[model samples]
Target chain A: METRNLTCINCPMGCQLTVVTDGGEVVSVTGNTCPRGEIYARKEVTHPTRIVTSTVSVSGGVIPVVSVKTASDIPKESIQAVMDAVSGVCVNAPVSIGDVLLENIAGTGAALVATKNVAAKQL
Target chain B: MNKAGLSYYDIVIIGGGPAGLAAAISAKESGADSILVLERDRELGGILNQCIHNGFGLHTFKEELTGPEYAARFISRFHELGIDCRLNTMVLDLKAEAPSGDEGSSNGCIKTITYSSRSEGLVQITAGAVILAMGCRERPRGALNTPGYRPAGIYTAGTAQRLVNIEGCMPGRRVVILGSGDIGLIMARRMTLEGAKVLAVAEVMPYSGGLKRNIVQCLDDYGIPLLLSHTVTEIKGKERVEAVVISEVDENRRPVPGTEKEYECDTLLLSVGLLPENELSRGAGVGISPVTSGPVVSESLETSVPGVFACGNVLHVHDLVDYVSEEAAAAGKRAAEYIKGGASAGSDTPCVPVKTGNGVRYTVPSYIHPDKAGERITLRFRVGDVYRDCAICVYLNDSRIARKKARILAPGEMQEVILSGDELRSFPDLTEIKVCIEAN
Candidate 1:
């Protein structure tokens, strides 16, 4: 059995969570303020994931770049691969906020979509 | 319009960031017709445009949203209201109209603002009420007075954020962050995600100035070392930042002689602190709080200058954008009420000053008029240091009025207490109101 200490990120309250895992399975979770914290702790101890956010260069856009983020949380370990794939890809201008730039990025099953609108530069 | 070709607005908000946008929306909703927002940037949304990270709008919208998404919600609402605004307009100065009486210009009945843009040359405008929402700016390397030659590699965390997220440019590959402020911690993760190596983050204080969640996700998740009680002692380079000397800091925050260690790096990111950008407030003759470095306000979010209100970072640095929006919306509603000739300071009621003691640094709306406050008033303040298992106590004179248990209180997180107006009214003979922290 192993114990892990974590801070709950579900809210700004940042409740400190203590979890005990047995054979790679969450046995007990304590020190959480709410049920959401318990669920977060169980997943966090077993498989940690994060939503990767970054910017992609845009050709012929008003601004040089448009911000992008994965459609869903990807495995923490695949963050680098997702970033590497997104960095090498650039889309043309007139991109909307929800435009998907890369589908199934790094095989994480999460599409990378633009978070900001980049209007086309007037000629 | 005055002889200076001044246009007129019922409410003129100084910034178009989250604060200003929320303020304008509330002001218009409260029945103020002639509302105008002045944005210095080419577009709206202010700094949120460059902040692409999530974890925002959780409090306000009850869901996680990226910075731009959160900002776009307000922008769309602002447009829906048909509120007028000037983009790419930079405000130059704020001036009081000088009410003729010894009562002082604190209740600046009429105020003038000067701004300039490409399409419009320098222009002046008069407002019935002004909401200062200019927000705060990050402290640069010059503010630290670190011994170093001006190099090409050093950048404030915020400036670097704009470069990476907006301009799509990288500041450097190998990085040594000077402080563990939220922006610095976020940048530590950002640079690494962008394929740059973040060497380490050094904080002068014993405790991190950022949120505990950020410390875990941004640094610990990425295996970045956070050196607490440490600061950059010297910058070693001629043309660019070749290296920096990190030294452990004593309790006095002074560098220890033998604790100096060198790290080879090409870039340095400073996130020491944020100061409320209150130059315009000072120019308008608003009373400034030495502790907050922001305007001294009343319970209604009205500044010393009555009709002129302040909120967001211009009043005091807020840790969350949701709080900024919340505070600013109150400022907007109050400004609209003030414009309607309601809640005028001409009443005979005296403004009661709320005193701070024992670990509390300062409180916004330092003064309160008991009757003017609605059902309850929320007083927000920051602690001077890290505290654990303490109670936030509110006192009416020497008597304990309220006590709430606090699990943790840190300088990085803001603390707030709600004072019931009915309770204050019950103590009609109350002489002093104080807030302090006590060991539980």
Candidate 2:
């Protein structure tokens, strides 16, 4: 059995956790004060992901653009590719908050949505 | 008058941290000549030097970089612009010279700065405009009133970070960290990597104050534990830290009687909080924001006093160094404009006060000028606890100007929301802006 030391991040009590594992499966987790730490540790040791925020080009807008972010965490390694996909896309103005820009980005089941509204550029 | 001995500059910024350096660069770029930066430390990086962790620069640079790397990018530009920088100088005081009808010029601003090397005992400078960027200081154990015996192994999170990352010194063989701020969380992993056993991180708050990424990356990967609603009730040891008593806390944050548990450890690290260094600003009689504990400023980053500006951690605690540099650049550019006689054209409009309501601990830029054109106001705030699926709203006199949904909000990380001038213009008679958490 291999033992690992983890810091619980689910809450402020950064508990120094000890996870006992056999092969690839977790056996017994100790030192966690909350259930979130166990869930966090399981995901971290198996698969880790993060949410990404970036700007998308918008035409005919008062500000010429708006900021957007992924609705969910995507694969850690696929963030760059998703950013590349976002870099080439542009939306027309009159975009409102929570407007979907792209869905299932890089097959990560994450949706890119607008964070603010930008009026269409005046002719 | 000793006018011949004094060199007049358009703006003189004290400290060469990200804020001061950025201010100088902006002031110079905005066509203000005679701009000088005074840094007491030999290096220009400031607190960024001790922060060797990643997860910075996502907002401004669009790429993640280490703290020093982010600082180096700005320092390089500062050098390229040939901004006059004097290292090893400390600013003593700022005094107003004369009452000026023109509100933009800092001509009456005089600063008495002191520095001592092998040669010079002290030096001073007077300038047209002054920007306070002295940054902040970490809270120590004395402030926490920690019920513990005085021990040799207890250290602040920043001190431990400096010792380990900068000086390559090992803090201890076994560690117990108090508070779950970013520094504390990072140090837990640092000590573990250095082959030390971290017993636990105790937090008085019900939630973690650090970023979600740090929680996962620093703690989960290593199997560290976090105890919510728990705190270190007592410290045990005489000459050295040998053990700490942990207890569960109730809603009132008082330790419960029967939940006490003791763990043996050799080191205790505190990462409680940071307070802004605003003595210079206060000495100059600049109005301070109760929320930020910094200067209250308009959209142009000008403080309550004319010709004075503030930015970086001095303005408000920031989660990312990139934003600090970004905001500092704005303050720098505006200071330059003021020196060049190109300040915004208008009478000083009365500012509406902003307050923190539910869930938010505090908010920066406590005052707002609705008439300012194209000015984007950034409100930096901290939540009171750990909240998930919460909506943060900015309300102006009962009207919701902006609202954003957050998946998680922790006290450890600072949150920022920008409101454009166009939004402010919609409510011409705006009396106040109140930020509060709608749901958690």
Candidate 3:
């Protein structure tokens, strides 16, 4: 059995969880207080993905640009490639909230969208 | 035409989070004839809803509970007390209605609060006191200036937490967490358990910023590597997150040369820090502490503005929800007193601002009025870094007012030292207060 120590971040308890795995599958899980910990552990041993948030350059804005984020989750390994595609891209000012930056970015099924609007920079 | 306008309440709290909810309950219990709570979210519970893990309510409830459970305990009590809570309602603005003392009151103080709701369309209410409890927001990726091609797989820990716990969505397959705060450590274990390989939890600090228990349980137990004094210096990806360059930092927190290591991963989670949500507080003209980024309160938890009180994470970031509830209870009790005209009499003697000294990061209850009889001052603050066998000394100029020995101290955790009203009486002519950590 492969014993793994896990940290429970679901709350501040930060409980150390011990997950015992057999044959590359979770055999028994211990040391988690909430179901989220067990879920976290099981997923850690399996699949994981992350939500991405970043900023895009906006021409003619007061703050130089505004912040943006992926409205949906994306593949874990594809984040670097996705961010690279977003790096060179610049949106014009007057972008509205929820405006799409990139639809189906890198074919990851996650759309990069604007979280806030930067009105065209005043001369 | 006798047009009946919206009725006014004794107190109106915005943001229905722990701070707002606790303030409402305290206002009612303190004899505020009417109180209202406006929450923008669909439900009353704030960020607590997404926090499904336990370790809450130990101090206030004397039992361990999850985030929802802790919030539920207060929410249920709020309902039991018949506090008016309007969910799915957003407060747009707070305006001073009139000058103090013009309306036959000793001080002319009135607030006009505008709000909107699906059921009520547009509505306005007036109140004598307003409490700002909007809480704080997480630091995002750009704030760190992490050199990288813009990437897809980076997320704030809170966002990922919400997606996983509330929406039942996976965030990534192979995860690497930045800044070993509690969230990142927890997520390291969380993603790992969900069948994701957490490459490492990298922190720039020499010592782990998260709780000691987290280091043991989250990273050590899971065999997830914790690279201390290291940081993700660069993000390498063309279209998505491919790999990251991790580098070690010296004591000054500057990256060292020739120690760069590369880790291939698809995702990065940032749990760097939390900043107090002070936009509404600033708009309301409340004095904010530069260090804590929350309101500067006296012993009674009353903000610089009279009748305005704050509590919970809105007041300052608390390490535990139990402490939040406890602090909120105090704010609530004080708000109730203020409404009942029972607040501590104003002091003619100028209040002295407390400063943090060696080994201390910051101190709360920024000012103390010695004349405020019956007030027990609880000073909450944090240390600079990890320490062993240290003593926390509260000093008035050169004279020490209070001192306590601590077995261990961590900057990630807040510490509290309570001074009873009787004890404060001894230092009546206080000019200054200082909290310092010294070797035990």
Candidate 4:
């Protein structure tokens, strides 16, 4: 059995989590104030994941860029590829929050959606 | 201020950030019909608009959200509640009016807010209650007093955030961030993601002021070195940034004679500290604490000037926006109650002073009004230094009333102790309470 420690990012509490694994299988989890922390630890030690946030160019918008993030947490190792995909992306103005910009972003199975609203520039 | 330009609002929130938005929503829910939110920016959401990062809305919404998503939730809610707001409005002055001025007088004063809007020009509004949620601003290079010539490439972390996330413009390709505050650490990653090389993050304090997770994900993940007990001593640049001289400091935080290294970088970002924007608070005659550099608020979040309340970063710099929203909602509710109650605390009200004990730095709601402090009041404070395996103790007068065990405590992180009003009401002669940290 092996044990590892991780910080729960579910909330601002950032609860410290401890997970023990038995030969690549689940054993037990502790030191979490909430159940989500335990769930996070179990997945984190197995297949780590992260939500990637970035900005994409907006054409003819009130602002030059609109902030975006993955619709859900993607595999941690795929963050760089997702960013690389995001770098070449651009969308039209009047982007609303939750608007999907890239489907299956970087082939990570998570959609990249706009997080901020960007109004179209008035002529 | 002309009479024709005078408007009326039951409550006027000074800023339309997360704090102000939450306050306006709760105020409307609390039955204040006329509430106005003033935002200086082109739109609402304040700094959150520029903050595109995830890891927000954990407590309030129970889901990890990006900054804009978190703000959009509140913005939608605020809109659903039919709250009124003026965008591109800058509040120029806040003043207390109609003070009785007599000793021991409890006739709470009215508040007047003067603001300039791009559409409406300068306007003065009479407010039955004012909630200060102007938030805070980052400390500039002048605050650090570092030996440097004025250069164009130096920007505050927040400024860089806006430039990158909002304007889609990169500040520079090579960056050296000063101070390991969360903003600086986050920006180190942001600059990196935007294709800039973040050389290092230097903090004067031994420990990073940012959250442990930020240190891990932002700096450690990117392989960016965090130089603890070090700071940028000199800026060697003229027109644009050329380089920054980093030096180690001793126990007194004074630069050591021989330990210095130079980093060739085009941009320098400062995240040294944040100061609560208090010029408006001071103009309103709110008693400011030298420690928090914020208003001395009571349990009801009421400032020294009656009918005026403060919350969010304006009250004290909170690490979490969730806490700010929680506090602002309370302030809004209290302001609504103040309007409904229509009476001020007289000379008979209890002024229970809440003081800091060993290891505690300062606390909000410095005074607790036993009668008015709802069912539970969360006393938030920061510690003076780091501690492990410690206990937080609350002493009423001389008797220790409550104690909670803490695994660890740090100056960078804000801590809280919940006190029940019933507990305080039980103590009839309670004069003061002190919160302290004890080694376990």
Candidate 5:
């Protein structure tokens, strides 16, 4: 049996949860004060995923870059691959919030979308 | 603009952020006739415009949203209400009008707000009630007083956040952050994602001032070390930051001798703390609380001035914008009641002074009027330091009124204790309510 300690990010309380697994199967979950913690711990131990938020280069905009995020959570192990994909992207202004820049990033099936609007610079 | 140019409104909000927007909505819903929101920025959202990170609106919207998305929800509602708003306008001064005994009202004082913008040189707006939501600002390098040369590469964490997230400009390649504030922790991950090398994050306190989730996702996820009980002693560079000398600080926060270590870096980011912007409040003669550096207010959020109210960061720094919105909404409702003459005219009854006891930093709504106490009243406060397994106790004139068991309490997080008006009314002639923490 192996034990993995995790902090449940469901709420600001940040409950410290312990998940005991035997042969890659979650056996017991403890230290959770809420039901969501159980769901989070089970998923976290088996198939961890995280939403990626970062900035991308922008050209001819009032600002030099635009902030972007994965439309949905991606696999935890694919975070670096998703970030690498995001680093290579350069979106031109005028970019609007929720505008999809990349589809199926790093094969995680999550689109990268802009979170803020970047207006074009006026002459 | 002359006094004749003064536009009369039932309520005038001093900001256009989440707090102000929520206040305006509440006021309008409370049967307020006219409302206006004056924003200094070019757009509706304030700092939320540049905060593109997610984790917002989990409480209000029941789903994670980016800062801009969270702000847009309120902005849309504000527009739907057709509330009058002026962009790029800065309020210069606020003065209360002398009481004119005209109607059956007890105290009648209209507020005169002086504001200026490029379009309108200077305009004085009159309102039956005013809500102060100017928010707070980040503590700068000057406040730190470290032995450092004035350098171009040094920036406050919030300024760097605006530059990178909004302006899309990289401040530097290599970075060292000071103070471990929430903004500083968020920026550490931001800089790393932008391909900038983040060497380390240092905090003078043994404990971190940021949330544990941020420490996990921002620093730990990126493999950056957080140096507790450490601080930057000096900055080395004439034009830009070249290196920073860090030293371990004793418990008393004094730097120890012969413990200096140098790290080569091009940027230094300070995320020390935030201070409530209360110049407008002070100029208006509002009572200031030394503990909060904000306005001392009543349960209805009324300042010393009868018609002036304060909420949001201008009242007290809040860890979550959700609470700011809620508090501002309450202030708005009360201001509307004041304007409509629905609230009680005078306070003949004695008011209770809420005091902070051991381990308590400060509480919002510093005073409480027993008669006006609503059904559910929340007393929000922060701790001076970290404590585990503590019981937060509330005393009404030496009698235990309420107690809440906290699994853990940290200065970075805000704690709240709720009391019902019926319970408070039960204790007549109560002079004070003390909120404190005791070990379990």
Candidate 6:
């Protein structure tokens, strides 16, 4: 039997959830006040994922960088690889928000989209 | 418009950030005749322009939006409503007047705002009501008083953010963050993505001052160490930061002896805390709260000076911009009511003071007048420390009125409770409403 303790991130409440499992079979969930906490705990224990957000260098734009984020949550383990891949990527000016910067990043099938609109510099 | 050769407005809001923008829009919608927003910044979004991170507008827009996107939504609405705004204008002083001894005058109260701008020399505008939304400023290294030589490598977390996001310049190649503020955590990830090495984040508090999600996503995911109960004791550098000495702190946050650790870094980022920009409030003779560093406000968000209101970070430091918008809207509505002659500063109605009990820091809207508080009142507060399996309780005149169970609570996050006017009437002689956290 194994026990896992986690903090729920669904809201500001930050519920402290404890999940007890025996050989990968769920035994009990405690400390959760709502069903969302229960579901968060189970998914957190297995197949955890998170949406990655970062900035990419921009050329000829009003600003030097544009913020981007994964279209959806990606595997937790691929966070670094996704960041590594994003580090080398740069976009041009006139990039609008929701514009895709990378497709299928780190084999996670999540595209990186621009989070801010960067207009071209008036040179 | 009254007074010879003086520009007059029904409402004058002192900001153009999300708070001010939302306030102007709400005031216009609430039927204010004339409104103006004066902003010191060149743009309308304030800090949101550089805060490019996602996870904003979850409560307001019902969808995930970036900081700029969220702010843009309000800014667009502000323009759509044809609200008057002045950019790059700085308010130097504010004064309240009581209609110049004309008791029978139509205007009962007035405010004079002295401001300056590059294009427009010195200007003064009088208004019937004013809403303060000047926001807050990050605590700088000078406030920390760390032993260090005057160096160029040290910068506030927000200043570094503006440099990286707005100017597209790197503050340093190697960085050491002094506090675990949210901006510091987010900057850790930002600097890493921008090809900078973040050595570590040292926090004097035992717990991180940032949100748990930020800790996991920014530090834990990035493999950056968060040294809790530790802080930078010294900065060792001549021209620029070359190294920093970190030491473990005791329960009182004093550095312990013989626990010093050194790190070689070119940059030291300070994110110790934020102070509400209340100098303007003080200049206007507004009563300030020693705890919040904001104005002492009533249930209607009216400051000590009648016809004057305050909200947002100028009122209290909020964890979320969504709440700032909500609070600013309330202030805007009240300011509009004051202009429409529907509100008064002095009321004979009994007012109950809201006090912070053990384990809590402070509450906004320090006083509540149940008679004029409308149908409901939302009280927002922060905890002093982390608590597990705690119950947040509200008492009116020593009788428990509201209690909610929480699995965990932390100082970094602001919590709120709602009390309806009907519920407040239960205690007719209510003198105080205490909000406290009790260990379960």
Question: For residues B15-105, could you state the per-residue lDDT of candidate 6 as single tens digits?
Answer: 8998898889999999996999999987898999888777788899888787877887898799889999999999999988677667834
Q: Indicate the worst ten consecutive residues by lDDT in candidate 5 chain A.
A: A6-15
User: What DockQ does every candidate get?
Assistant: 0.75, 0.04, 0.04, 0.59, 0.60, 0.49
Per-residue error (Å), model 1, residue B91: 0.9
Candidate 4 residue pairs in clash (backbone atoms < 3 Å):
none
Top candidate, metric DockQ: 1
lDDT of 5 by residue, B1-440 (tens): 32566678878899998889889989988988689999999888788887878888877888888888888888888889888999999999987766455573434777788999999999888887889999999999999889867988999999999998877788999999999988999999989887899999999999989887788778987899999999999999999999999999999999999999999999999999999998988988889999889988888888888878888888888878888888998998998998877764356756888899999999887888877887978888999998888899999998987778888898988888987887877897788899999988
lDDT of 2 by residue, B1-440 (tens): 13636566667787788888778888888888788787887578787756655555776787655566567677889889988877777777776454445473344444443434434556555677878889988889999887868989999999988777555567898898889888898888767755689888888887777766676766765678888789888999999998999999999999999999999999999988778888888888888877678888777788877778889989888766777878888888878877766664235555677778899887766666677535677877788777777899989888887789876676777777888877777886888889999884
Better of 3 and 4 by TM-score: 4
User: Any runs in candidate 4 off by more than 4 Å, and if so which?
Assistant: A1-42, B1-5, B99-108
Docking class for candidate 4: medium
For model 5, state the Cα shift of residue B118 in Å.
1.4
TM-score of chain B of 4: 0.97
lDDT of 4 by residue, A1-123 (tens): 998877776644567778899999879989887788888888888998888999999999999999999999899889899999999999999999999999999899999999998899999
lDDT of 2: 0.76
Q: Given candidate 3, what's the lDDT at residue B315?
A: 80
iRMS, all models: 1.2, 14.0, 12.3, 2.1, 1.7, 2.0
For candidate 3, lDDT tens digit of each residue in B1-440? Answer: 01126668878888887778777777777777688899998767698766655555766777555566567677888999998988899888766544643763423466677889999988988877777778788899989988878879899999987766555467889888999887787777667655689998889998788876667656775678889899989999978899988999999988899999998999989999888987777776778988779988887787876777788887888877667767877777777777777664265645767778889887778887766736577889988788777899988878887779876687888898887766666765777888899888
DockQ of 6: 0.49
Model 2 chain A scores worst on lDDT over the 10 consecutive residues at: A7-16
Better of 3 and 6 by DockQ: 6
Candidate 6 colliding pairs: none
